[model samples]
Each structure stands twice: as structure tokens, then as C-alpha cells.
Target: MNAIQIKNVTKRYKNVAALHDVSFSFESGKIYGFLGRNGAGKSTLINIIANRIFADSGEILIDDLPAKENIKVHEKIFCMSEADLYDAGLKVKDLFKWINRFYDSFDLDKAFEIAGKFNLDTNKKFKALSKGYQSIFKLTVALSLMVPYVIFDEPVLGLDANHRELFYDLLLKDFQHNERTIIIATHLIEEVANIIEEVVLIDQGKVLLQDHVSTLMEMGYSIYGPAKEVDAYCADKNIIGYDELGNLKIAYVLGEKTPLPKNSNLSASAMNLQKLFVKLTEKGGI
Candidate 1:
């Protein structure tokens, strides 16, 4: 069953249109990469899905029921964003206890385990932790909430490399054991590329593309050789973007299956999510 469905959703702020007729459905037990450039409405869509904000027009359904302020739907979904949601004066331990009491599916033991892994000090006040630790605290809560759907908006924002890898590993382990739907909206596409099964690319508050990663990669190719040779070979194709350095020219092209000429280095290349996002949203058309 679809976990969440958004139909013709639109949001406006004064003279600006934040979202324009956005529609999409999210399935259960899959990791989705919600990608877009800055000001592309990733956070806006996520907030609507979390029911934290109301759309100006259209509707949102969670499990076939209207999701607005529904306690059942709220219990099944958890959203963690960059905005601080905890009480600044509360100690870490107090925050944990409060969350445990509030969330029906909260796992205190798992929360403690995650806190230990991150070396978080429960005695410290919420405002006392470093920026990275603050993010770590929020991540631990999201993981231990054990909700059916977890939406993370740049969860690893202030984390270092080691902690970031650890977060991914822990997230993967939890997914394997709990089988929940995870939606990650972030600019760090390449970091989570391997873990994300499907991708939803948005631009100007509208979805540009949504498909399985493997299928999307099959529609694009990268070729590299002498500048003149590579240019000649890609002459008839839609060259999305390219780069040239000295005698070498690497070009990104989207087309059907075709044979490469001899004397040119040619191979089917995997599409980088970051590059694909830039190419699709750069000119305001996908």
C-alpha cells in the first residue's frame, strides 16, 4: 500500500508560490532520496507530508485517509528537520524521557544505545551541546521513535565524516530490522546514492523525475576521449553537460543504446545523482 499520497498540493506565501500542483505517492519499506537544489521546495513538501503545515489547495492522504491533524497519521510519521524542536532549557535526559512518553513506539533502550555510540552527555542541557551533537541528538530520537515513516531533512548537516558514516550504518541496520519507509531530503546525494532505491527529483516546487535509480542510470551515459573525438561522437546526441581538460573531454549525454567509434575510450557509466540534479534543474526544465 502507498504510505503517503499528495494530490495537486499548492502552497503560497504572499507573492511567492512555494509549491505548484505537486503530486506524488510514497510507498512503504523503501528508502527514497528527495533531491533538489536550494529553494526547490524540498522542505516545504516534507513539512506538508509531516502535517506540520497546511497546503493552500489540494489534499494529502496517509494510508487512504486525510492526514491533516489526524492523531493516527501523526503517530505513524516522524519528521526531523534542521529547525530545533527540543526545549532549550531541558536536559538531554529530560528530552529523552519526554519523547518516550509522547511517542507510542518510542524505544528507550535503543535511544540509550544510540546516545552511547555518539558519546552524548545526557546531563547536558539541550542548548549546551555542540551543533553536531544537537543534530546527533535529533537523529537518535528519529531512530528510536520507530515510526512507520521517518522523514529526515539533512539529518547529517553538522556531523563529521566518521559520525556521518556511522549514522548511515545505523540507519541501514534499523531499516533491515524494522522495515520502515525512510525519506531523506538532502543535497548530499552521492553519499546516500547506494542506499537509496528510488529518487524523486524536484525543481521549482514541482517533481521533475521519479524512478528507480537503476532505470534512470540506463537513460544516460558519459563518454571521455580526445576533445575533438568525443565532441564528434556526441554531435547527434543531447549533451547535458561536459568538461574538457587539455586533450581529454568528458561529456554527459542522454540517448538510446548506440555503438561508440573505435580509437575512443568508451564505457557505460553510472549516473551521479548530484550531476543529474544539476543538469535537470540548472535551466529550469527537466
Candidate 2:
């Protein structure tokens, strides 16, 4: 079943259109990558889904019911946005307690378990923790909430390499143990590439592409050869992007079974989510 459904949702800030007729459905028990560059409306879309902001027009449904201003609907969703929601004066343990009260599915034991893994001091106030630890605390709360749907907007912003890997590991493990829809918005596309089952590319307040990760990669092909030869070979194909280095050139083309020049070296390449996202959002529209 679709955990959330958005239909013709539009949000505007005076003259600027933050989101334009955005429509999509997020299914249950799948990990989705909400990808885009800076100012691509990824955060705006997520905020709307979280019901933290109201859309100028259109409807959003959680569990097939309108979600706006619905406390019950909001209870089932957890959003760990870049914006800090914890009180700076509150101790880590106190913050967890507050969250536990707010979220029905919150597991205090799980939160403490994750915190222990990170070596976070429960007695430290939120403001006293380092940036990385702050993020870890937020992640701990979100993960332990075990809500039906979790939306993480750049949750790994200040995490180090070790913690980043740990976060992904915990996310996958939690998903396997408890079925829930997870939508993660992050610039670290390569790190989560293998874990995500689906990809959603949003640009300029619109969704450019949404597809299974494997299927999308299958449609991408790369050609590498002499600069001029690569260009000539990709002339007729729909090239998503390319790079030129001295006499060598590599071009990424999107298609299913396209003829290539015999002189050029062509191979079916797996698309890097980061590279594909950069190419698609570079033009602003897609």
C-alpha cells in the first residue's frame, strides 16, 4: 500500500514557486532516495509531506486520508530535518524522553542502545554536544521512533565516515527487522546508492524522474574513446552528460539498445546516482 500520496501539490513563497504541481506516491517498506542539487525544492517537498508547511494548492494523503493538520497522520511520520528540533538547554536523555512521549512507536531502549553505540553522553545538554553528535542524537531519535514512515532530510550532514557507514547499516538493519517506508534526502548519493530501491529526482519544484534504481541504471550507457570519435558516436543519441579530458572523452547516453559507431569503445555502464542527479538538475528544470 502507498504510505503517502501527493496530488498536484504546489507551494509558493510570494513570487517564487517552491514546488509546482508535484505529484507522487511513496509505497510502504521501500527505501527511496529523494535526490536533487541545492535549491532544487527537495526540502520544500519533504516539508510539505511532513505537514510542517502548507501547500498553496493541491492535496496530500497519508494512509488514504488527508494529512494536513491531522495529528494522527503526523504521528505516523517522523522527519529529521536539517533544522534542529531539540531544545538546546535540554539534556540528551531529556530530549529522548520528550520524543518518546510525542511518538507512539518511540522505543526508549532502542534510542539508548543506538546512543551507546555512538558513545554519546545522555547527560550532555543538546548545545554542549559537537555537531556530529548532535546529528547522531537526531538520528537516534528518528531511528528509535520506528514510525510507519520516516523522512530524513540530510540526516548525515555532519557525520564522519565511520558514523555515516554506521547510520546506513542501522537503517538497513532496522528496515529488515521492521517494515517501514524510508525516504532519505542527501547529497551523498553514492553512499546510499546500493541501499536505495527507488530513485526520485526533483528539480525546480518538479519531479524529473522516478524509477527503480536497477532499471534506471540499465537505461544508461557510457562511451569512451577519442574526443572527436566519442562526440561523433554520441551525436544522434540522447546524451545525459559527458566529460572531456585532452584527447580522451567519455559520454553518458540514456537509451535502450542504441547503435554506436564501430570505431568507438562503447559499454553498458551503471549510472552513478550522484552523476545522474548532477546532470539532470544542472538545467534547473529536470
Candidate 3:
């Protein structure tokens, strides 16, 4: 297969399982949102794929080739990790030159162009750049790489509003141009909700769900009305949970079959991506 297949991969740290028999695939030419809460195995999974860390069991394959310790497979995947991999003293321009040499397909001119757009001073050393500018520089490098698969771990970290907007705009433009597999591991679900075609949700070292965002949204909804009316409406439905305020209530129901509430005053609306995520991953009973 051409997809990045992660087959029953597992990783653990002491007694804590970072990834528990997790299996998922990133198909070619699609944007995916890799979502999870803190310590939910997002970084662990990224590290295993990037060969920065090894899985205790199972394997990861790219186009049928094993990924662990395989240089050829790593060539096809580029992960801009959250950790700083660059030397702080290296000048931005020199770092670009080094990257061009390492990755033959890297577009130096394009990287420079993006740097200019972000007002990133290429002459300055990496340590001299602001936090936001550091992210911008890394994003510029990732965007310039002409690779088959690109995994961005917190790509928008430390970026301001304007820069974040520009980053997403450029990311879409780049994806449209190349149509490669782009996986964004981020906490800002609402920001990337519309951009991502698919969602892979992980919680406590396990995949809770993986599906099309639109389909997932369609599978769940919110019903609002009086407490008694809401309870009656959700009685037969699959209620994930609900909120109560005075005499009013809002119940979150899952599944496609939604009949009209018996009471006319009751109202219902489709669940958005953020709401669905929270409902699924909340620690306490929801």
C-alpha cells in the first residue's frame, strides 16, 4: 500500500503505556488532524515514526517498507518535531543552505521567500530570533521540503494571530500544489477543523476514533430544551452527556437517528469538531 501503515504499534515508559496497540494509517495526498490531550501519546507516536524513538512492539511501514531504522523510508517522511533540532548558533541562511544539501528536493529560494514574508531575519542566528519567529523559520523549512509525507508537531506554537493565519493560508496553498500527506498534531482543534479532511483521535494511549470530520459531526448532535423535555428527548438516544442550567438543559447525543423531539420548544443542532472531541476525551463521566 502507498499509505503510512502503523500496524498494532505499542510503546511504553516504565509502567505507563504511551501507545497501546495503536494502529492507524495516513493515506497519500490528504490532510489529517492528529488530536489528543496532554500525555495522550501524540509526541510518542510522532517520535516513533520519525525514528527518534523505537516502539517496544509492532512496526510502522511506508508504502510496504519498514520504517524503523530504515534510512530509505525516513527519506520519504519529514517530521518537524516540537523539540528544537537546530543548532542555536547557526545563522538562518546557513541553516537553509545545510538543509538544501541534506534534502536534495528542498527549495532554498522558496524558504527564503517565506522567511521574507514573515520578516524573519535570515542573517541573524537562530538563538537571536523571537519564539514566534523561530516557529516561522521552522514552518518555512517544512513548507519548502518537497517530500511525500510531512508531519508537523505543534506547527503553530508561539505564532501570533496574523502569522498563524498566514501559516494556514500557505499550508493550504502548498497542499493544493503538491497534494501530499500532511499530518498536523495540534491542540487547536477549531483552528484546523475546516482544513483537515480526516481526524485521528487518541486518548490515554488508545485511539478513541478515526474518521472523516464531517461524518463524525453528522453522527452526533446537541439537543437543548427544558430539563424534563430534554431528558424525554434524549431518553432513547445515545447520550454522551449534558449540561444543566436552572430549568434548561443541553444534552449531547451520538448516532445518526434523530427524530423530532415530542415538545416543539426543544431544539437540536449539529455538533462541531471541538465539542465532539471534548465529549469523547473528557476524563470524568460526561
Quick one: ranking by lDDT, best first? 3, 1, 2
lDDT of 2: 0.86
Q: Which candidate is the best by lDDT?
A: 3
Please list all clashing residue pairs in model 2, or write none if there are none: none
**Against the true structure, whose TM-score is highest?**
1
Model 3 residue 28 CA deviation in Å? 1.0
Off by over 4 Å in 2: 221-269, 284-286
Q: Ten consecutive residues with minimal summed lDDT in candidate 2?
A: 263-272
For candidate 1, give the lDDT of residue 284: 58
lDDT of each: 0.87, 0.86, 0.89
Cα-based TM-score, every candidate: 0.88, 0.85, 0.85
Per-structure clash totals for the candidates: 0, 0, 0
Error of 3 at 184 (Å): 0.4
RMSD of 3: 3.6
In candidate 1, which residue ranges exceed 4 Å CA deviation? 223-238, 242-251, 256-268, 284-286
CA RMSD, predictions in order = 2.6, 3.3, 3.6
Per-residue lDDT of candidate 3, residues 177-196 (tens digit): 89999999998898998899
